[model samples]
Target: MIDKLAWIRIENGAILTARSHNRDTYYIPGGKREPGESDHEALLREIKEELSVDLILETVHLVGQFEAQAHGKPAGTLVRMRCYAADYHGQLAPAAEIEEMVWLTYADRAKVSAVAQLIFDSIHQAGLLK
Candidate 1:
């Protein structure tokens, strides 16, 4: 299983997502934790690296944990995604391996990873997403 972290940035009823270089589907902006890194530390680092923005540490909160068969991976491979909600400073921009950044609504569900689709469903059910 691949463990990953993600930042759930909601604005104007949409969630921020990223599409990596040469990737077709988008993902919530975050990445796997480095060796010996805590979730917050990893999340902050990944977000800054991928989105070119500094996450407000004090504003970070766990949104949920989700698991699904890893997208585009071989059968039996799984991905466990730990998602968080946070406020950030600086303008959002695509960086590093990220090719594009987008704000997606419920209608854009099919454009994201499977676990991300679950995250969208949960947020929509909570009436937090459009």
Candidate 2:
């Protein structure tokens, strides 16, 4: 199982996301699972590593599961993204290999990952975004 954790942070009603330096599309602030880490732990660690912010675990709200073909990989290279909404501390800026950070609305779906687009669709259907 290719597991991953995604942080769905809603700021001023817009979702805070990042675009990898190597990819054209944006993605949720997240990463692949680490050894023996739970979903929440992985999310916290990834958020900290990528954004240099400590995510409040208690504030992290589970959104839903998103499964899609992993971008830039083979057709069968699927990913299961477990998403969440959360509050965090410190200013969010690009770290590691991230190229840019953007607050995106549902209208920018085409600029995000395939699985991220699915999450955007669901968020729109639920009346959470435009």
Candidate 3:
């Protein structure tokens, strides 16, 4: 299993997301933690590297944990996604190796990752997409 963390930055009713370099599906920003790193530390570093913005750790609110088949990978390799919502600073810019940064709404679930699609659906059903 691959452990992951992610965050949805809400702005003007839109959610910040990233598209992979070779794929169209969008995903929330965050990545795996290095050895010895805490969840907050990993999330903070990954977000900054991927989005070019420093995240305020205190703004983080635990959302929900999710598990799904890892996209484009082995069937049994699952991704356990720990999610959060948080505030951030600086302009919303895609950085480092990020291919594209996009804003998505509930209606855009079809263009998201396998796990994210489920999360999006849940958010919509619970009236949290807006």
TM-score of 3: 0.93
Task: List ranges where model 3 is wrong by over 4 Å.
Answer: none
lDDT of 3: 0.85
Model 1 scores a TM of 0.98
Q: What local lDDT score does residue 42 receive in model 3, on the 0 to 100 scale?
A: 92
Instruction: Name the best candidate (by lDDT).
Output: 1
Q: Lowest summed lDDT over 10 consecutive residues: which window, candidate 1?
A: 68-77
Ranking by TM-score: 1, 2, 3
- Candidate 2 on 1-130: residue-level lDDT in tens? 4678899877565788898787788998999877888888988988888888999988888899999998888879888999988888998889998888998998788898889999988887887776
Candidate 1 vs candidate 2, lDDT winner: 1
Whole-model lDDT values for every prediction: 0.94, 0.86, 0.85
- lDDT (tens digit, per residue) of candidate 1 on 32-126: 99999999999999999999999999999999999988889998899999999999999889999999999999999999989999999999999
What ranges in model 2 sit over 4 Å off? none
lDDT of 1 at 17: 93
What TM-score against the true fold does each predicted structure earn?
0.98, 0.93, 0.93
- Which residue pairs in candidate 1 have backbone atoms (N, alpha carbon, C) closer than 3 angstroms, thus clashing? none
30-95: candidate 3 lDDT, tens digit per residue: 999999999999999999999888888789888888888988888788888999888888776888
Clashes of 2: 0
